[model samples]
Target: AIEHDYHDDAPYYMLLAWFKRVPRSSDKVMLLTHGLMNINRWDLAQELQSIKDDKRSEQGTFSKD
Candidate 1:
């Protein structure tokens, strides 16, 4: 199971991503259960960067007044 404790006072997100005994998954290989909890940190970084850019744009516009 993949558990991410993002905050100390907030509920964590848990995702069952693996098998206990490496069960025979050949027939069920089509399942995308694995990597289901894979968090792409870069995606969030890009979002934060976008927000910063927007703030800068707003600041520039106000500075021109």
Candidate 2:
């Protein structure tokens, strides 16, 4: 669906599609991470998870401020 809609820009447009369709940022991250893992891209998935963790930590700190 995203590839069909984006054509040549699917890679970049996927994020837009996710945000438009998924509602939450964490769910967006999970969707992308799981998709990558399904394709055996474990390294990328782990990296994304790390980034998500970092962002959550940052949000937690900011909320305490």
User: TM-scores for all candidates?
Assistant: 0.41, 0.66
Best by TM-score: 2
Instruction: For each of the candidates, give the backbone clash count.
Output: 0, 0
Estimate the lDDT of model 2.
0.86
Kindly report the root-mean-square deviation of model 1 from the true structure over all alpha carbons: 15.1
Off by over 4 Å in 1: 1-8, 11-40
**For residues 1-65, what per-residue lDDT tens digits would candidate 1 score against the true structure?**
12343554232222233333346855222222223224555554555566667988999999999
Error of 1 at 39 (Å): 8.4
lDDT for every model?
0.48, 0.86
Residue-level lDDT tens digits of model 2 in 1-65: 88577687866777777678875546778888999999999999999999999999999999999
Q: Residue 9 in candidate 2 has what lDDT?
A: 82
User: What lDDT, from 0 to 1, does candidate 1 have?
Assistant: 0.48
